[model samples]
Target: MTPATIPSRFGLACVLGSALLLSACAEKQVILPGERESVRPEADLSESRIRLDGNTARAIQLPAQRVNAEWTQGIGSPAFRVDHAALGGQLQHLWEVPIGNPDSRRARITASPVVGGGLVYTLDSGAQVSAVTPEGAVAWSTNLTPASERAIDSTGGGLAYANGTVYISSGFGLLSALDARTGELRWRQKLEANGSGMPLVRDGVVYVVAGDHTGWAVDAGNGRVLWQIMGAPSVTTVLGSGAPATSSDLVVFGFGSGDLVAAFRQGGMRHWAEAVAGNRLGRAVSRISDVTGAPVIAGDRIFAGSHSGRLAAFDLHGGEELWLARQGALGPVWPAGDSVFAVTDLNQLARFDASNGSPIWAADLPGFVNDKPRKRGETWAHYGPILAGGRIITASNDGLLRFFSPESGQLVGQVEVPGGATTEPVVANRTLYVVSSDGKLHAYR
Candidate 1:
């Protein structure tokens, strides 16, 4: 991949205003994933469809298997990648549980529900955290902040599961660890930077990208501050970027400015960082280069997509560009077998060649309000195209969960969720969980 001189818009630096002067910023220099040459076509704003190259126009075989038993983090796992998992006989709705207080709409659900330890964990719109049975029995529900702290103002943050613990990052600027089974608070730490999305836990560390366009590494066990990394802030961002993906020794994630960064998982030591936003076209939010998609780590390569920017692969170790394409996506792209599936900015669900970043197939989905989702604004859909069984399952705001063939992108099955899923759906123990913004948890078996 050829190196670009620009930076990513994922980090929210625009709102930084004068705060940019209060802190240090990384120099804007893009380092590619590998030594390979750039083979990507220029981004075309005119189409929601992907033009296939000769190799991509033909048939491609994708892996039909998935990881059984867990959707540990917001993006499946800390690596942000999972194989195809098996599903059951039917997509029947088993049960539903209210997520947060029903009376108030001020707090919107922002985090995907994660399942672990046979219990589904959710952080609701009202800054309330709950753990329940896969069958929808409420084991416990608790507020994350003080009574005075829970307000209609801010709604960000999510939950992550690892090592029998649940890590919570809140728009209230609080990070806390709770016992997975008991809902007991282990520790909580306040931050100068507010948490934006789901906090990822790997190798005893919890990684967070705050609203301030900064990255943090918190000790998962004790909630200690290990180290922090700062990136150029954008006046605006694409919903606080995606959850960071980790592998080898690097923790990589995108920022509001569309920057893809690689840092040591431990000490925040820099490996190589670059801008994922390929070109700066317009000043409109349409020009925002935020990489809202989480990075997918497979072997030595990391796959990522940006909103109104490029979809590219980079070398995990040395930060070299492998290949790129013009496709803007907000949710984390799913990589399985040999194909990577993405729900793009144009409302099209497409698959790309994992090895060379080639376009394999493109299919459209019903457009959701996510078309205009942003931080400090109204909530949007958490489109889930999770690969399971031999199909891809995705949820929308219309109380629907649709399934499609992984091979042909053909419609296979569909189901209606209660109140619809505002965030992405998560699966564990052969059960799929969708949490609606209305604080309702719908479980399908």
Candidate 2:
């Protein structure tokens, strides 16, 4: 693997208005598996500069929470937007099963758990894919690692399901179609480079991005590349790639180079490209401009964020910039009705007005481990601000699943994850599935 293909283990950190200042000094104690820390005083945000916009704060509303039957893709849908999914009752601890090998120094699990056909799917750091039942039983398992000396280090691919087939992208430069029920391989195609992100399948076509930043459209039935386009190359990127988001006619992909490109869904003709690159002053991690989170398309707008301190929305038709914010999104921006919720680079879960990109409210999540200052201790990374059951849901590397009020950005409730989550949680049929960094599949009802 080349330098750019290797996943970086660095935590994303940057100053976002007053949130970082408040969170950095705000003292909160969280007990890890084998460690405990003293309680610290909470920073007073009453006089802080970041505040909800008065004009839209009172009018903000989210779509009604609806029960989603299946989460077939990593981001829930081809558009990468699952607005207000219905997760019923108190999320009681249900069952847990080991998925595969956990994250090591050589590889890490970056793909979110995908649920479909009554089974939860996960891709571990070693390129192993496992399917688990709702009762936490391993139904089938398959290894996609290529037969090569360097294949042991392969990591960071994702899964998507459509019809009765599971589409898989491998870090070993292969895309394979598998039987969703039997785990039998149907077809496989070799790509020009290793896969960087999850595959998105829609209407008999599969879309994926490679490590070289190339977008490919493949036939879902047979693993044949229909069309492919090369994107601008970058030497440095965060850990993983963002899955491409698609509408009826267009598919938008975010590259590690901070380029957001939109191409025709059927053909690979470039529609437009925009750079989502910007850096926070004095922050070294902010220099990486990878769009680690998948771009989300809701209605007529496209929302995406980069690690380099930029959260932007663009017109879906012309790819024109509609609004932009300075806070880099740590994960995919959850676009509800009038607001967009994101776990920001500052370790704060913030709500932004989807209309004008105005700050609504920001709630601080766990930042540095042991509540120590950045660089002095390890920082807890957060993923997924998905709106479920009338609350904003976010999973942390600190083994906690937090729920926040969508209306106020206040912490409402939290649950302990067994081994700490490595990626975002996915909900299917009113059940939540989270993949822990220790390679366990945790299911909650």
lDDT of each model, Cα atoms only? 0.74, 0.80
Q: Kindly list the per-residue Cα lDDT of model 2 for residues 307-410, writing each as its tens digit.
A: 87789999988989998898888788888778888888777888888999888888887766775444445689798978788888999889999998878776
Give the top-scoring candidate (lDDT). 2
Give the least accurate 10-residue stretch of model 1, judged by summed lDDT. Answer: 47-56
Predicted structure 2: lDDT: 0.80
Positional deviation of residue 2's Cα in model 2 after best superposition, in angstroms: 66
TM for every model, in the order presented, reads: 0.81, 0.85
Tens-digit per-residue lDDT, 175-268, candidate 1: 8898999999899987676675678888899988887778889988899899988877886675434688888678886777778888988689
